[model samples]
Target: MVLLFRNLALLLAILLPQTVQAELVTKYDPVIYDPEVPEIVAIVGTIDARTPLNFSRALEEMPRATEVILASDGGSVLPALTIAREIDRLKLNTTILPDTGCYSACAFLFFAGNERASSGELGVHQISSDSGDLESGQLALSDMMDVLSDYNVPDDVIVDMLRTPPEEMHIYTPEQLATLGIIGTSSSRVAKPTTPTADMSKKDLAAAFVQDFNRLWSLPNAQAVDTLAEKYALTVNYYGKSLTNFAVIEDKRAFAERWPLREYLIEPGSTAINCDELTCRVETIVAWQTSAPERGARSRGRALQSLTLVWNGSGFRISVEDGTVLERQ
Candidate 1:
């Protein structure tokens, strides 16, 4: 009888629902209810097998909610994937509020956000099974990878995930969260003056600046938004329209998602610069190719760009930018 009960207990532990415990707290915009600030549904507590069904019920009760906020240490891996699928199905944004954390299985929920974000802790580690069966653990890992792949998580991040053990977590730093396409959370870049140094001329500054700009622009990273925003003025004559830097960055963010792979080349010998006391005007030809493997889409082009820049004591900021495509494929 003792042996039978002991085996039964072990089996029950293995079969227990793996998920979270938490109430969905809703935050409304106002009595006036602004669509711009969509109502949020907060999920907090232990995650177990029941969380997905609970989430669905909560959504039904709060039909207007468009974002989900998560705070959890972790939960079962499979059910977290189920919740993530539903989040994706509804195109809901996921957030981890400042000071709160979403770790382990919660990372799956965070990434499923149509627009993922977090100011709080977001962490991941290898998936494991309670049964101590290596085969079951391997299957869980495979399933987790498949879900992450569906969400377009970066290959580098996946590598990090694979290497981290179940006992240890890889917590994402704020900059990593932002630059890795996990979040576009506001982060400032401090620009330093290079002109005061006797070793480099203004021409050299401009040349080096162009190289760094092109190199960063070519990366399939989310940091481009911050980098370009740092180099642009509050208002810009961008491509064609007069737009605020904020709007420009938003457009850039969307562009990055649409094309996760890119290559930008400043056509050799095609750059011209004219400078005065506090400003510079530059003209360059750039050839570019961008692709989205998930969507099976590719775009390639060469364009002539004219830019007007103003010195901000530290460096040049683009105030005007005009581009004309010379060729497209």
Candidate 2:
């Protein structure tokens, strides 16, 4: 009778597949990369529920890290807030590299940095709960606001956050971030060439604008492009294509990465300048060579470009730029 009972229990166990629970799995595990600077620790991954613990372990191992470089898409909000709190306690500087992203709850970690620097994407949106309870959502938002307030984030930034929907994100430009007081103006990540004074002659302004534009292509940075965009409403007509300010900046970034600038020269007799009290326009022909060596017997292609600059009250900035390959020998 005991053996019969044991056999019956085994049969029941075999029949009850639904009694077993599946283990929950996280999408990504946090990892620290080799430091570019001795005091900087680079971390990359999703900020899931386990991230805080993982990050804590990383911090424990690299207790001397004074800065953190982050690239993440974000995940569980509670863990993200916990990680942010840890970052604040450590008083570490935070930076995001160009072409990378720190989105959603990841932005909270960025804001927690004592000194924040972002040359890449920093995106934010409204926080929501999976349960879809209105009260829960409100409580979550309130908690987020408290966190931001504790970090001294400006009121305007909070407003922006509130307005952004959970399904969509707002990507902050360096200039916008500075204006919102989220980042310091003098931060290396957002530094750009100074604009020319209003008193300068249109010719001088045009010359300065050209010089800066060339510098932009030589070493492209989003901050510099954003500065130029803010100073003058940029409109580019390139190779029969029309580009807005953001598009122009993105194109320049892509171009710079693909072919680093070796040398650039503006043709002497190819420049024309016109000005009025409210605005000025400069048109010029420029030439450039890339650092990449030529393939086979062909020389590296040289770009001949036509550019236009417009001046508002602030200073001159690129308004239109068109380019074509002038030489490939």
Model 1, span 174-266: residue lDDT tens: 665765556742122212235536787565566656666677777656556555666678899988899999998888888888898988889
TM-score of 1: 0.49
**Per-residue lDDT over 1-329 for candidate 2, one digit per residue giving the tens place of the 0 to 100 score:** 11112232322232223444432112224645332223655546677777788777766666777877767776777778888898899888888765567788888999889889876778888888646899877777777878886787655456557779877887886656764457752243333223455775667767666766665544434444444444335466654678787886676667555554345667777767776665555666666666543422213555555556655444555556666776775
Model 1 whole-model lDDT (C-alpha atoms): 0.70
Q: How does each model score on lDDT?
A: 0.70, 0.63
Q: Where does candidate 1 have its weakest 10-residue lDDT segment?
A: 28-37
Measured against the true structure, the TM-scores of the candidates, in listed sequence, are 0.49, 0.48
RMSD of 2: 14.1
